[model samples]
Every structure is written in structure tokens, then in C-alpha cells.
Target: MKIRKANQNDLDEILNLFTDTISEVNNRDYSPSQIKAWSSSSKDTDRWLLKIREQYFLVTEEEDCITGFASITNEGYLDTMFVHKNHQRKGIAKTLITALIDYAKENQLKEIITDGSITARPFFEKHGFKVIKKQMVNRKGIEIANYKMKKLL
Candidate 1:
């Protein structure tokens, strides 16, 4: 697998990966209703596109297909990380996070933060992030619980 900066062409695939990952991999930790409300493709497409355009987006590709993606915004103040379900546990997220951290360092960012799902909290913690709080974010009137995690750069 190769990791590189994301381009506009990668947006659709990245979005699809994120949607599928949330519904499948993340479902183990989040209820179906919460997952559906939080990651609904309809609401996320525009947001994903905006992030891809405005943030430092990176993608992991294998055989010309996007396998994972990550985005850091506000000079790394916020981040969104996702890996294709089929590519999970294969170091794809590690590569994506490494790239985001490098981007943050290059930008001289003081910190990085993310609202991490239960499936992702351990990964963030393992990567030096500390939980600042447990969050209950409502999406489409459905309560979705997550952790507010931050890492000092």
C-alpha cells in the first residue's frame, strides 16, 4: 500500500469507504440507528467534500483503489480518520494517522483532536491521544456517544 495526498478524484471513494466503515466496522460499538444517523451518506457527502477541499487530506491506495483516508483541519485542531472495512487491522489507519501527525508538525500545530467512536477510541489512545471527555452528540435526533480525544503535538 502507498500513502499520498488526496485529490478531488478520491473524494467519492473516500466517502464511500467512510460510510461503509461506520455502518459495518463501527456497528460493533454503535447501535444501527446511531450509526445511520451519524454517518448517513446524504448528510456526509457535502461535509466530506468540504473537508477534502479545505483540509489536509491524505489517502492510502492499493492497486489504484482508495483503502483509507484521513483529514485534518484548522491546522490539525480537528481530524477525521477512516479506513475501508476490508482494510482494517492492516496498518492502513496507522499510515493515515502518521501522515496527519506529520502534516500537523509541518504546520506547527499545537494540538490535534477528534471525536472518536468506541471502535476508534483505543486506536487514538494508542497513538498518544488522551480522552478529554465523553461526548453524546445528537445526529438527526439520535444520540451518538463518542469520546473527545486530544493529542499535544
Candidate 2:
């Protein structure tokens, strides 16, 4: 797999991967309604374009197919991280987070933070993020559980 910084041209593919990955991987932890609502953001062209241009967004590809993508703001806010449904647990997420962590450290950011899904919380914890709080957020009228986690660099 190959990982690189994302550009505007990668937006549509990134959104596709985002929707597919979340719908497949997050189903066990999040209800179908929640997943639908969560993945629905993939259609927000403006948001994706802004993030791709303004944030340190990266995508991992295999044979020209996007398999995973992650994005982080300059302020060390880890906005999104997702691996393809068929490619989970093969170090895709680790590679993505490692890249983001290195980027944050290089930029002298004090910490990296994210609101992690139940399925993703363990991964963040393993990467040295501590759960600052457990949150119940409503998405499209569905209450979902997640953890607000942070790692101090």
C-alpha cells in the first residue's frame, strides 16, 4: 500500500472510502442509523474539500485504490481516520496514526486529540491516548457512544 498527502482530485475517492469503511467496520459498534448518519457526511463536498486543502490529509492506496484515509488539523485535532472494510487490522490505521503523530510532533503541537468510536478506542489507547471522557453524542437523533481521547506529545 502507498500513503501520500491528499489533493482536491482525491476528494470523491476519499468520500467513497469513508462511506464504505465506516458502514462496514463500524456496524458492530454503532447502530445502522448511526452509521448512516455518520457516513452521510461524506456527501458534504464543501467540508471534504476544505479538509483536504486545509488539513494534513493523507490517503493509503493499493493498486490505485484508496484503502484508508486520515486527516488532522494544524492544531492537532484528529478529525477522521478510517481503514477499508476489507483491510482492517493490517496496520493501515497504525500507519495512518503514526504519520499523523509524526506530523504533530514535527509541527511542535502539544497534543493530538480525537473523539474515538467504541471500535476505535482500543487502538487510540494502545497508541498512548488516554480517554479524557466518555461521550454520548446524538447523530441524526441516534445517541452514540464514543471517547474523547488525547495523547500528549
Candidate 3:
């Protein structure tokens, strides 16, 4: 697999991966309603375009197909991190996070923060992030639980 910065051309693939991962993988931890609400954000094209255009977004591709994607803001806010549902446990997420962390360190960021879903809490913890609090985020009127986590770079 190859990892590189995301471009405008990668938007659709990234959105599909994000929605699929939440619908399939996260469904184990979140209810169906929550999954639908969360995945619905994929339709927000403008928001996604801003991330791809402005953030340190990266995507992993294997055989020309996107397998995973992640992004971090200038302030070290980890806004998105998702591996294709069929590609879980294959180190895609680890590679993505490692690259994001390296970018953070190079940028002289003091820390990295993220709101991780219940299904992703363990993965974030394993990467040296600690939960600051468990918070409920409302999406489309559905309250979903996630952890506010941070890692000092």
C-alpha cells in the first residue's frame, strides 16, 4: 500500500470509506440510528472539501484503491481517521496515525487531540492517547457517545 497526501480526487473515495466504516465496523459499538446519523455527514461535500484542501489529510491506497484515510488540523486536531471496513486489523490505521503523528512532531505541535468513537477508543489508547472525558455528541438529534482524547507529542 502507498500512503500520500489526499487530493480533491480522493474526496469521493474517502467519503465512501468513512460512511462504510461507521456503518459496518462502528455498528458494533454504536446503535443503528447513531450509525446512520454519523455516516450522514458524508453528504456534506463542502465540509469534506475544506478538510482535503486545508488539513494535513492523507490516504492509503493499495492497487490504486483507497484503503484508509486520516486527517489532522493545524492545531493538531485529529478530525478523521478511518480504515476501510474490509481492511481493518491490517495496520492501515496504525500507518495513518503514525504519519499524522510524525507530521505533528515536525510542525512542533505540543499535542494531538481527537474525539474518538467508542469503537475507536482502544485503538487511540494503544497509540498513547489518554481520554480527557467521555462526551456525548449530538448528530442529527441523536446523542452519540465518544471520548475526548489527547496525546502529547
Give the winner by TM-score: 3
Worst 10 residues of 2 by lDDT: 136-145
Please provide, for model 3 over 21-116, each residue's C-alpha lDDT reduced to its tens digit, 9 standing for 90 to 100: 998899999999999999999999999999999999999999999999999999999999999999999999999999999999999999999999
lDDT per model vs. reference? 0.85, 0.91, 0.96
User: lDDT at 5 for candidate 2?
Assistant: 96
For each candidate, what TM-score against the reference?
0.94, 0.96, 0.99
What tens-digit string does per-residue lDDT give for candidate 2 at 1-153? 899999999888888888887888888888888998888878789989999999999999999888899999999999989898888888999999999999999999999989999999999999999999999988777788999999999
Top model number, lDDT: 3
Clashes of each: 0, 0, 0
Q: What is residue 148's positional error in candidate 3, in angstroms?
A: 0.3
Q: Ten consecutive residues with minimal summed lDDT in candidate 3?
A: 8-17
Q: Across residues 1-153, which tens digit of lDDT does each residue of candidate 1 receive?
A: 998878778877877887898988998998889988977753556777777889888889999999988888865655678889998899998988888888889888889989888889999999999999998988889998999999999
